[model samples]
Target: LLSLIDQIPEDQRPPIKLPPYDRFGWFFGRNESETYDGTFQVGTGADHVQNTGVMRLWNGANRTDYYRDTCGTIRGTTGEVWPPFGRLRGTPPNVTVFAPDVCSSVTLQYLDEVERYGIAGLRWIGNDRMFDNGVHYEETACQCTAPEDECPVLDNGAMDVSECKFGAPATISFPHFYLANDSYHADITGMQPDPNEHRFEMELEPYTGVPLSVKAQLQVNLHMRNYGLTLLQGIPPVMLPVLWFRQTAALTDELADDIKIILILPDIGVYVAYGIGAIGIVGLVLAIYFSVTRWKLVGPEELPPKRAQPVMP
Candidate 1:
């Protein structure tokens, strides 16, 4: 029977979709609540505080891309911040291609997670406008260039200028909480055969302050569950777990402070059980107390008052 199964063509085999493991993507965002100054009387208050940004999972494709910028706004003596005017305040362009061909069915699950966070739009770029004492001020325009290894085409025929332009915008509605300056990652496995397998993983991290730096890292771990299965069958059952780590660092203290890290977990059953158990214990104790009090109030006198007097005599 096993031999017959082996004889069948690979296409005839049933498609097996496994649940994504610890494959995780992280995003960081600054919480803005900390920067508020209560005192109404103030000269151009200190620079507006930007909280650490938020994060999200990017599971659309095997390739990860990053784009970022630092924006600033000045405060007036009356405690008002101005927005970037014209082209000066506009966010830079960050674009990439996303399609089913670049990832496996299982890897697409990250898209579902992203939808939960309300980050559907493909706009990943950010710009800050700064005001110096109510005056529109401009910061040095940061240089933008792709890494040598990332832009292999640069080494080839006259660098493809088209590649520099932003691609068609792709929108993804993630189902998780995500904020600005978050990181995204995707990993695809089971692309190769036998001991030599092909897998692809990528990362994208965004930063929002001056001297911004984005770091994206991907790590893959392959473990053989049953070696014997490989000898008997052409394919071996294995477990592949991928992890993505992304971080954005900036020189500005406020921008660095705006960096937020969020860790989420799927199973909250333990917390639910604990809450239920606590409520049940409290209910049980109250019931016991009420029952004892009622029992104590019901005395023998309720049965017969005359009989009790005769017993005392």
Candidate 2:
């Protein structure tokens, strides 16, 4: 069908009568969110990855097509056993392409900025230098040479993630949604993206390095081009935004309840032990008091006088 669309000229191409397009997208039930069902067919044909029960993100499966930047250099100068994919890499583009989420961080300074500015903060958190968290927050967002930057490129605080996911076929992002720098907004001329709708965030308990609430969000897209294909000839040769989702783990009511339990259980035990200890102490004092009083007062009152021999009485 794609080839057919490509072969058809613009004038010959009618309204392109099609059904509800329920078949437009393929579902693997991997990252589909119940909260959203947008118009675009996400992961339509590409990124067809499924669980192999391996309990790992990259299971040696090729889930993406290899694409080059304008410089004609394939990503991953190292030996990529899987074309666009190299061996199991943790940071930069490698992990992001096959992995679900990139572990990134915002500096204490930037987080402080967010707190002060609310959601409109723009403090440079230094390019993904945070190492406290085990996740490598790639610096540099969008990884593009400008123009047609509609697809999401995560903020990841300050990490440059341009090298992620081969930097083209699909983009791994922080779910900035749209609250990214104005420069990104300027590049997106194809879509009307809402910053509030697509924004991703993390609320961390700074002192403890605990993520109070977090939304590890990212987006997947398709890089399309005319390339003499009649099907895509009418549209601009750009990376089209398909679907964006997040892996959100948060402090929910249940988790909060568990935490409360965790906090209160010890205290309850200590308090109970203290109460028992107090009772024991009080009992010991009362016993001592009763014995002393009986010996000194009751004993003296009830004590029989020392008697002489019976013969004398």
Candidate 3:
């Protein structure tokens, strides 16, 4: 919807000047993630059970700049909020259930989704969440609503990057628009947001901590509020949710078997190398013994043979 109308004549543009960026408060992250709704050491031998505690942000916060969204910070403090693992506000549900090396039987419940992972050998996998395709709860990422709400925290059902994201007020909602609040859907025209059509979930293998199948489900939207006397005129006064997409990557059974083979081959190769080395070492010892005693250099009768010959002479 935005691509068709993005081109405005140079002279017909709005008087208000947009900043070089859309939002300029926070950074980004990597595979390094902090757990939510719990306090547990990652490598403490327990990764199944979830203990409730402070949420944390660990590693992979590189991008300090947003792509296109930018507004000069003057009123509210639009400062960078670094990711530190702590408190309810900091922990996101996505990274909370599982931590590296720490496998507790404790299952964590996030909103409508309860995380109950099943162990596979030495690792855990998404037994509970793998099939969790339905909408667990309402996703409210915006702060325009009730005062007591926590906005922008992922575990709160959605991830919000309004200021530091692409220009059109965007919020990433879970796949199954299951209980998408009315406020997010009421205004957009020509879009019928249905619960059944949009719901999505992920499948993960606990042992490898690798996503067996991943469908990065998200919804794109434009926050259409207060569009007075601008190019956005005639737009509805509501959050114009445009579309949602799920980017998927998965491991087929054959591919999964291939991966397992790939993972096992190296270990087998190492063991074979070790076994060959051991055999080679034993052979070397035998060869050295044979070479050293080839002519009976240290035979008990050697000294006597010389003495007996001298005596006989």
Candidate 4:
């Protein structure tokens, strides 16, 4: 019905006589209760550090058919968990995660060091490289098949997820288009991209890899285009912002204290063991020194004279 209506001239097109529910409810889903289930494989225990919480299979599959080439391949961890970063070794340049929503591995660059709840952590934020759409980063060329004059290439920092979202003209970006190109901002109003509010960040305790705080913000947009259709003639080709969301979490003080004890007490235990060993060694050395000194202090002539007189008798 929509395709047929789209073909009609805008002036002659039939009005939407049906009610709202009948017209658009199917887009949401079936009203009846149904179990939407999937299988997820996560790395655990000793394997977690090496595996870094790998999403081995999602819905019983290890890959996605969202893109044409390797871009569709499901690589990296599930983004919720990461390998324990060595504080002594310092922070890396970036971190990668296979975000199911984006249907690809996204990399967040190391922004800076941050502290929360009295615990220090490394903060990583989504940069222009994340959704570059091949403008600045050649590695992301496979993410989009549209020509250089496409909607996303014109506006960097937003990736077209239409293929992943079942052919819907959808795109994803940071909240308020934080790192997006100026062209996207020119089409909209009241969009203020502040790093404090709009930046998507993950702050993790470097030593234990615990998430001290996380603010994962993402905006979903409708890629509006006329497509030379009669009913959609006046629509401009733009990434229209539909809705934006921010998912946030922070470590509580109680949890922070528990983590401190869990991470710090072992080093204290080693120091205590070393102190006890040192005390025992010192005591043994003093005892041996005193015994030798006492034996030497007793004159040799006094002990030898007494022994010789007894033998002669």
Best model number under lDDT: 4
Overall lDDT per candidate, in order of appearance? 0.26, 0.37, 0.38, 0.74
lDDT per residue as tens, model 1, 187-257: 32322221111112111222222222222222222322333344435544322333323333323445334
lDDT of 2 by residue, 1-313 (tens): 6456546787776443333332334233326675222221123213432211112212232221221231112121111111222122332121111222221212222333233212112222212332111123223222322332442233322223333322323343334324333433333465454544554444432222223444445555454555454666787644445666755554555655554554467679999999999999999999999989888975676888888767854
Q: State the lDDT at 91 in candidate 3.
A: 29
Residue 29, candidate 3: alpha-carbon lDDT: 30
Worst window of 10 by summed lDDT in candidate 4:
18-27
| Candidate 2 Cα deviation (angstroms), residue 52 | 24
- Model 3, range 269-298, lDDT digits (tens) per residue? 999999999999999999999977864786
Runs with alpha carbons beyond 4 Å of true place in candidate 3: 1-62, 67-166, 176-211, 229-237, 252-254, 277-313
Please say which candidate is ahead in lDDT: 1 or 4. 4
Model 3, total clashes: 39
Per-candidate TM equals 0.19, 0.40, 0.39, 0.79
Number of the candidate with higher lDDT, 1 or 3: 3
Candidate numbers sorted by lDDT from highest down: 4, 3, 2, 1
Q: Candidate 1's error at 291, in angstroms?
A: 2.2
Error of 1 at 244 (Å): 28
> Which whole-number lDDT from 0 to 100 does residue 211 have in model 4?
83
* Candidate 2: C-alpha RMSD after superposition: 14.6
* Model with the higher TM-score, candidate 3 or 4: 4
